[model samples]
Target: MEATTTSQPKTISPPISPTFRISGGRRFSNDTSVAYILPSDQDEVKRLKLNHDLWKELMNGLFKSDMHEQLTKGIRVLDVGCGPGWWTLDMAALYPNSQFIGIDMADVFVAQDLPSNVTFEQMNAGTGLEFDDASFDFVFQRFLVMGLSVEQYSSSVTEMKRILKPGGAIEILELINDYSNASPAFARIGSWIHQAMSARGLDSFIADKVSSVLETAGFKNITDVNYDVPIGPWGDESGEMFLSIQKLALPAVKVMVTELTDTTVEEYDKTEEQAYKEALSHQVSTRFRLIYATK
Candidate 1:
């Protein structure tokens, strides 16, 4: 009988970000903070639940083959800008051995009863994290473009690298700003939102730059995955979910735009409404990009 020797796989140290902190500044006023810090709006909470459920389902379908083995084990995960904590909770349940921490500006929407492994914190992503270095096995974030500027995005990625354990992974998911289809009206509205965001120094189209940003932040072995996420009232499988999400998103867009642009609230609202109507008649597309990088 011949004995075969198996070689041990080489392990590489994950990327590490320089120790630095960015000031969040007085971004939110006392009144605005009171409103945002309070319990999340009931309608918005429901929409988040629906959106997470749809996303989980979609991910399962899309990554069917890898879901069971890779995602269902002991993995320490950190979710930055984890709105409502849906994904964090789901991941906690899915990976019982894994611990999940969700950090967001508001903790109002987080579940009152979370699993033992799940934790929530109210922290700004632009600043330094409270956690110790090399703490997590995976760092995950999604749809964070709204709250982050390009500089902040770069800084946050570097922060994620710092807390990630050797050989750990970082995953970032974001959507493109362009959403236009059969109905030109939705396109018009999307354009307005895009312009507003751009004007405020926020890049709604930042998805395209994830890879470069990660690389610049010292991440290696980076993989970029792009998917087309449909928006509006189209009849595609994810269309209903998209429409529901848009309903909530449109209002948020208006508020953010008004705050950033110092524009009249009424004008922003009108623009959002018009864009939503156009979205219903057309099949708009939003680009979703997922950057998976290993330290």
Candidate 2:
């Protein structure tokens, strides 16, 4: 693939001050260390796949940028916090002329014998990104609100900006709200999950505020596109996909949620079971936001 001949001009970015207060800095026992509410295991891979499928259905495309057109024109791309490498691999297959790289805390499900243009690296999102400045034409991140602290979230975007080519496009897709129009069981699960994340110093609602943060990090011409996903079997394919992801994640996260919310394991399990049933009746929904900007 050919690289762009000239770097785009850099713009002046605002200060990187955090607007939200995410809680205490607690760590989780997982491969990523700080991002283990659902832990990096086989179930985690399935969860990533399910999430990818849901996004594919909702966005009707992998990205909202002109990256696909640029891919054929030889634009380099980076997928940050690229769990399981699903997005990286799929994009690589479709755009052979574009070089694609996926980076995460671990290669939990990264495939061997990847396409010639594709690469995978193990790295933490909070620490410095291990790449030179002005390296990529496009940088994409998704679903990191659950893992990164408020400070880290801002810094990580700064890191992303550092690696991006002067006019590179950065796209972030995040789920800001996990509950709306819920039954009692669904509300319990949603409340506990929200409270648990906050107590552990994570922000489950950062999706709505990412555009502003990107602006603070010096991005320009930012655009915010929103999507609402219904949660429940009756909500059709997207809902079923969400339910499958929940089935894998909920069991692993039960201990964390119950301990923080002061609920018995048995009671939590029963509530989750009821919530699953209620989901079939179309009782829950979530909000996702996609913020894209130029560095």
TM-score of each model, paired residue for residue:
0.78, 0.86
Runs of candidate 2 with Cα error greater than 4 angstroms are 1-36
Q: After superposition, how far is residue 134 of candidate 1 from its true place, in Å?
A: 0.9
Worst 10 residues of 2 by lDDT: 3-12
CA-lDDT, candidates in order: 0.65, 0.75
- List all candidate RMSDs to the true structure: 10.8, 9.3
Which residue pairs in candidate 2 collide?
Answer: 13-218
Top candidate (TM-score): 2
> In candidate 1, how many Å is residue 241 off?
1.7
* Candidate 1 local lDDT, residue 33: 21
User: Model 2 scores what on Cα lDDT?
Assistant: 0.75
lDDT of 2 by residue, 1-295 (tens): 2222211222122222232111222223443335535455555666777788678767776888766668877878999989777788778777889999888764463655667998878788876789999999999999887768777888889999999998899999987747778788878887888888887777888887898899888899999998877776767888878888778667757767876778788998899898888888755887789999998
Instruction: State the number of backbone clashes in model 1.
Output: 4
